[model samples]
Target: MHSIHSTDAESAQNLTRYLADEEETLKFGKKLAACLHSGLIIHLFGNLGAGKTTLTRGILHGLGYSHIVKSPTYNLVEIYKISGLYLYHFDFYRFNDYSEWEEAGFRDYFNSDSICLVEWPEKAGNLLPKADLQCFLNMFDSGRNIEIRSSTETGKQCLIHWNTEKNI
Candidate 1:
């Protein structure tokens, strides 16, 4: 329902947006999807029922995916290929220890040609790769309050695109 943007540095920034409903959340996610590129690591922060998966579904929709976009809660990871982009959606909610991540060998998937979207990364401690963009979501009376922080130049570029798109 509202957007507030600010820059932290030349190549780092933060933005907060209020999503009044699921439709708005999806729309925002689509915009984010357009800014995604390979080799980007994105960490999503939110509680259960906080709309993380819905936003992920929206991103997949924006990327031209028509099939089901289900959370990888059970599978641990879901792979999607679209227009030469390899997206790896990961959920570490089930992780009981940092060793679980190392044992699973999930780091191998975060390669040059892969764009990783990780949820519940806190469960993995520092074992997970650093995120280019960090997204935090909280529940709001109307819907969700979300914040996107750019930690790398690559992430800043995406936020810049997202800001510009919102203005337009």
Candidate 2:
């Protein structure tokens, strides 16, 4: 894997990392969990087998969730409550129509009391709330490259916190 680096100049807006393998990705997610807070919406973009679920597992594990973490593809969404915080892991891959989002009554899920991590958000066709942070994961050779961008003040603060807390 390529060397991982964070650009301080734009640290408040974005952060990039190259994970050598699944383990690195999980570790990175764990570290990233420290920067998370309630009410942040994170949109994850990646193709199949791109380690999106693996990264989410790491983040959940870092947040002290001990149960098995799996993709919400079949279930559409999974709810986890940890330390008084509500975490909603959503997978919109099965969405055949944007109306399905509203029909499912998921609009209330994106509130100040919860943190929503959405996969295949494009499938929802802009019906979902605006993401505070957007994460892009791409496969590269035998590793993965990830870029996290902040789109709002809340996301910017998270990125800044990540910069201060990141070890790599």
Candidate 3:
């Protein structure tokens, strides 16, 4: 993995990196996991087969989850309890309308005691709450380019923590 850019502003912070392969992506995810906290909401943007699930798997692994981690495409969401934190992984790729989000009763999942990570969040429209952090993955000829941005103060703190922890 290569650091492309990193910037810190008053309200928003951005970090960009290049993942040369699947292993690097997972490693990056693991690094990100170390900086996660409860009540955080993250939006993941990527195309199909963009290694989103793989990255989440690495996060789970970093958080001491030993079982399988799969994309919640059909199930919409998967709940995992790791180190006393409730991590909700949601995929709205199959969503056709905003009502589906309301009907699923997922609003309650984004609480102060839990962390929410959503994929295909755009499909749900404005039903979901604003994400603290947004991660975008774009595919290139040899690998993937990941850009992580913090849209909230809490997210900025996490990014700052990640920057500090990653250097060591």
Candidate 4:
């Protein structure tokens, strides 16, 4: 995995490293979910079996979704309503044609009142909107390494909350 260092001095601005175990991964996801709001878009990047689905499950659980959360590999998209937040999970792993995104009319789902999490976002090419947060997961010796970058102001705010809550 790649080693990263951040020079941002703010307590909320720093690089955090954690063991890539399942529990720790879930904890990170839950912490991230607390700071999420409507209209948020998160792009997930990782190779196969990098735990994207696990992290997403944690996010859905944190959002108060009692039902089982599954990857949208086959369905392409899954919608859930929890705690007054509209959460849309999209998996583009099977996406071969860029036109499928528009043909499916998924862009309309990114409203000001919903949160969208997309996996394999590159599969959509230039058809998708910019992500608020871009998370890259890499496989390591023991497990995985995740690097999260704030792509927008809202994402930066979420990072602030994550930093404060985790004392990172």
Candidate 5:
């Protein structure tokens, strides 16, 4: 496992890279999915082609969802039922106004029975629920950089578990 401690937010922002071939990335996502609980919100931040969807695909695969996973950019949300878990994958890329979040009544989806993974969450402003984990993805020349930050105590525990399990 790799461990680095930053004294400040800026230092914490220094990126880390994982050259996870598809298999490894899937494995990582699966590991993360296993630790998830309902009502968890994962905020994904990345520019175009940063592999957010790829990571989400991994998560779905890990959750035992065999169907094809596609970005919900146009549809706004995709609901998946897997092993009694309601996983909502949301992509707000096409969102033009924050009011749409309210108009769509998306806040109701943040209940204790569902897990939400939101891409382009910035588009929702304060309407969206608080995220448990914030995952930042960045594009490098050859691979991707992934940084996971815990927004809540549960998220911190999840990261600690992942670090231990994956020896990251």
Candidate 6:
């Protein structure tokens, strides 16, 4: 038997959009949030102050969370259980060691029927799970430039549904 390593090129397909302001970013998140499903891991790639938390807030708002949405920088992870869905918002910016992720007993959170949105995933090293979607956001002169990439079959299907709704 031959073992092969192949990348999911189909999942590599990406969608790019421009947000002219914070509202647009929130709108985009609202639209994107509806596309997400259970057991999906979304990786947020951006530097500090790049609006990761702001986008997450929009996603939470779209998911029917009426309370305040804040970054879990100090808390490491914020647990949001609403409308029969469990959303784990994790921030690993403060992580100094890879083993710290394992030590934190966070692995159990990635089970089925849960959605994980991770910021600063790189800080977790290989301890993190493979992302179904990778969302990259960059600050721009007007607002932010955002790119979304699907990296799993489930993610691709989700994007298809998002496209059907957004006419993208």
Write model 5 residue lDDT over 1-168, tens digit each, in one string: 243556434323332447446566666677678777888899999998788888888889888899999989889999999989899999998889999888888888898899999999999998888888898987778676677888877677766666556545
lDDT of 3 by residue, 1-168 (tens): 545454345323777788888998889888899899899999999999888888888888888899999889999999999979999999999998889999999999999999899999999898899999999999998999988889888999888887777532
Tens-place lDDT digits, model 4, residues 42-139: 99999988988888888888877878988899999988999788999999998888888889889899989999999999999989999988888888
TM-score of 2: 0.93
Off by over 4 Å in 6: 1-12
| 1 versus 4: better lDDT goes to | 1
What value does the lDDT take at residue 24 in candidate 5?
62
Q: Candidate 2: misplaced stretches above 4 Å? A: 1-9
**Error in Å for residue 21 of model 6:** 1.4
Off by over 4 Å in 5: 1-3, 6-17, 20-23
Residue pairs clashing in model 6 are: none
Taken over the whole model, the C-alpha lDDT of each candidate is: 0.86, 0.90, 0.87, 0.82, 0.80, 0.85
Q: State every prediction's TM-score relative to the real structure.
A: 0.92, 0.93, 0.93, 0.90, 0.87, 0.91
Q: Indicate the residue-level lDDT of 81 in model 5.
A: 94
Give candidate 4 regions above 4 Å deviation.
Answer: 1-5, 9-16
Question: Candidate 2's residue-wise lDDT over 1-168, tens digit each?
Answer: 333446555667888888989999999889989999999999999998898889899999989999999899999999999999999999999999999999999999999999999999999988999999999999989899999989999999998887677454
lDDT of 2 at 37: 91
Clashing pairs in 4: none
Query: Which residue ranges in model 3 land beyond 4 Å of their true spot?
Result: 1-12
TM-score winner between candidates 1 and 5: 1
Report the C-alpha lDDT of model 6 over 1-168, residue by residue, as the tens digit. 111214434323566777878898888788788988789999999989888988898888888888999899999999999889999999999999998899999999998899999999999998899998899999977788888888888878777777668535
Model 3 lDDT, residue 96, Cα: 89
Residue 7 of model 6, lDDT score = 44
**Candidate 1 lDDT tens digits, 1-168:** 445434335323787788888898888788788888889999999999898888898888888888998999999999999989999999999999989989998879999898899999999999888899999989977689988888888888888887677532
